[model samples]
Target: MDNHAITTRGLTRRFGAITAVDSVDLDIPRGGVVGIVGPNGAGKSTTIRMLLGLIEPTDGAGTVFGEPITRPKRYADRVGALIENPAFLPNISARANVQSMATLRGVPSDRVDDVLEIVGLSDRADDCVSKYSLGMKQRLGIAIALLPDPELLVLDEPTNGLDPAGIVEVRQLLRRLGDEGRTVVVSSHLLSEIEAAADYLVVIRFGKILFAGPLGDLLEQERRYVDLQPEMESEIEDLASVYTNAGYDVTIEPDTVRVVIDPVESANLNRLAIENGFVLRQLIRSNENLEDVFLRMTDANTEVAA
Candidate 1:
């Protein structure tokens, strides 16, 4: 059995002069929540649409569960997707809406209630979709996607238009789904939301992938620095000079000098500073968060493109 839920090679889509998705390759491993993040117009949605067979690729090839994406019907039944807002009959109850969808998909009607419970909408199952909040509507969309009992679930900005609480709710729901052994691909512009929900991340910029891997691995690629505050503020520059001469990137502040180095090399940094007669007040590792990593990678890509 293939370990990947989704895979693509040279997936490209062009709109006359504009390339919405450039030559891109992606590997979405089976199980766990994978987040696809990109700036506006970075081709996140376009790539997803191609993967779901909603749009045909202009070039390249892809597979969902090892079935060719070009032959969508061959694998469509095993995958479920929620792209943009789910349209439901405004006057109908959530349950009825799901039932209609279940009917269309040939899913067992009994699974409607099960999906409703999965998305925390069982209590409001009788409420008309028009009366439901944006968050509730998103949940209903997810329930509909779940109706197929899909092995791979693809969601595009599932938390869009959601309030803070709603965002948290959706985040937790996606995490729980991944925990239940479903492979989930969730696209989002919000870095914080993805950090909280996803284990693996794919970051794209200007229709090209900037970074893709386990979140931890991406963070690890970012250089860790040791922040050192010396008792004598004037010694900051001298310490920075010493570290820079020793092949480390050094940033000097009012009372501290930050040197980019591995955590294990902190002892060497301290020794270098003490050898220069500068007493240290504090020494700590500055860990880069996901936002930092994302910004750095995307900004670097922008620079390269320029």
Candidate 2:
């Protein structure tokens, strides 16, 4: 068996005039939660649909468990997916709903109990789907996906429309699933949620992948800059002139001057300030968050594309 749970080479998809997924090459490994994050219409959905073999790619090829994505049946039984908001019979019990789907899939009736427990829904297993909260319903959907005890599980926008509490519930559930050694792929536009839930990340935008690697790798590569604030409110403009004279892209805030240079060079700014008779009120090195990094990357790419 291939070590990677999924791999794609030049995975491309087109919808007439628009290319929904553009030459994506992925080597997603097994046994960790991987988040595919991008803004809406960034081709996240289209990419995953190709991985699931629900839609054919326009140019490239991919595989699930080394089985060609073009032949989903080869690996479909080993995978479970919650492509979007899950649906269930509102009048039926959660157990019955799961059992019904399981029966249709030829999955054993006893698997329903096991999956419900995995999703923390055993206590409410018999509750009518109508009475379940959105979070509970989401868990029920996961239980449905778990019916086959798949080695790879894919969830699309799993926390969309959920309140904060619901988001936490799902985040914890993804962690639990990862801890059990299942390869889980979570798709979302929320970078913070992905940072919290996924060990690895594949960032996409405008139908192209921007970055793919361990989550820490991206954060570690975050651009670091110095935030300097001067003591005198009146000196802001003059202080900004100091860095501008030194060939830095300077941003002058209401009370501070920001230079787009490495934080390590902050000492030089301080020295320059003092030489120019400016009193430094505060100087701090800061790192941009992952969301900022991703946005900066995609936005830059957008400008280049245009």
Q: Clashing residue pairs, candidate 1?
A: none
Local distance difference test, each candidate: 0.88, 0.89
Number of clashes found in candidate 1:
0
Residue 232 of model 1: what lDDT?
72
Model 1 is weakest, by summed lDDT over 10 consecutive residues, at 251-260
TM-score of each: 0.83, 0.87
Candidate 1 regions exceeding 4 Å error are 226-247, 250-259, 262-285
Cα-based lDDT at residue 23, candidate 2: 97
Cα lDDT of model 1 by residue, 1-306, tens digit = 989988999999999999999999998899999999988788999999999888999999999999999989998888888997877899999999999989989998899999999988999999999999888898899999888998889998899778888888888889988998999999987678798889999999989988889988887877788999888777778778888888888877667888878878899998987887878889998876778778878888899979
Candidate 2 residue 102 C-alpha distance from true site, Å: 0.8
Candidate 2 versus truth, CA RMSD in Å, comes to 2.8
lDDT assessment of candidate 1: 0.88
Write one digit per residue (lDDT tens) for candidate 2, span 129-217: 99998878888888998888889999988887778987898899889889899999999987888999899999999899999999999
Per-residue error (Å), model 1, residue 180: 2.2
lDDT of 2 at 55: 92
